[model samples]
Target: MNPEDLQKLVTMTMPYGKHQGRLLADLPGNYLNWFAREGFPNGELGKLLALMHEIDHNGLSDLLKPLRGRGR
Candidate 1:
């Protein structure tokens, strides 16, 4: 995915729940894993989270480090 899309995923706030206002990318791995087990939510946000999960799972979070550093 493009950096802008990834940035939006990383910085977007959760609309609800205990982790509300937290960045999607910053959500704990266990939490995301739980979602994977239980199934992700519906719509674009869910898609983004699933994508983030894959990225994080592959240990390529560093690929986004530059974008994060750029403050996008």
Candidate 2:
């Protein structure tokens, strides 16, 4: 994914849900999987969630560690 998207994963908070206010990068794989099964929300949040799902699915979540706190 692009740098801004990666950065957002670590900085942007989930706007709503049980995980509201949680970092997108820190969301559990199971939660992302739930999205995969249930379908992600619309717009930018959905895009980020889908990206995170792929990262978590492939066990590459750590790739985002260095980008934390640098999001726009």
Candidate 3:
């Protein structure tokens, strides 16, 4: 995964859907899991979702903490 992507998770908002406008980093685990089960969307959004899913799945979300503050 690209290091920049970790930062993007904090910076980027969900472009569409029930979570639209929410930060990717803040999406609930259930939401991410739904994507995993249903298949992530295409392009960068999908990749980021997959990455975030992995992070959440393995309990490594704390690794993103240091990057979160930079977004604001």
Candidate 4:
């Protein structure tokens, strides 16, 4: 995905949960891993987080670093 897409994925608020309103990028890796093992939810957000989990696991979070600085 492009940087803008990555930024949106990171900054988007969680629609439901105790951590609702928190950014997707800020969610703990363990939680993401749990979703990975259990199966991700349906919808675009779910797909995005699943992709984020893979990217983060692969040490490519830096790919979004530029967007982070752009304040998106």
TM-scores of all candidate predictions against the true structure: 0.81, 0.93, 0.94, 0.78
**Higher-scoring candidate on TM-score, 2 or 3:** 3
Winning model by TM-score: 3
Whole-model lDDT for model 1 versus the true structure?
A: 0.78
lDDT of all predictions: 0.78, 0.91, 0.95, 0.76
Better of 2 and 4 by lDDT: 2
Count the clashes in each prediction: 0, 0, 0, 0
State the lDDT at 57 in candidate 3: 96
Return the TM-score for candidate 1, rounded to 2 decimals: 0.81
Q: Give the runs in model 1 whose Cα sits over 4 Å from its true position.
A: 69-72
Residue 5 error, candidate 2, Å? 0.3
Flag the better candidate by lDDT, 3 or 4: 3
Q: Show the colliding residue pairs in model 1.
A: none
True lDDT of residue 34, candidate 2: 98
How high is the lDDT of residue 2 in model 3?
88
Q: Write the per-residue lDDT of candidate 4 for residues 12-58, one digit (tens) a residue.
A: 87788767887777766887788899998998788877988987788
* Tens-digit per-residue lDDT, 1-72, candidate 1: 666778876568777878888888787788888889999999988888898889888887777666654454
lDDT of 3 by residue, 1-72 (tens): 989999999999999999999999899999999999999999999999999999999999999988877946
Task: Give Cα distance to truth, residue 26, candidate 4, Å.
Answer: 1.5
Q: Quick one: ranking by lDDT, best first?
A: 3, 2, 1, 4
C-alpha lDDT (0 to 100) for residue 11 of candidate 3: 95
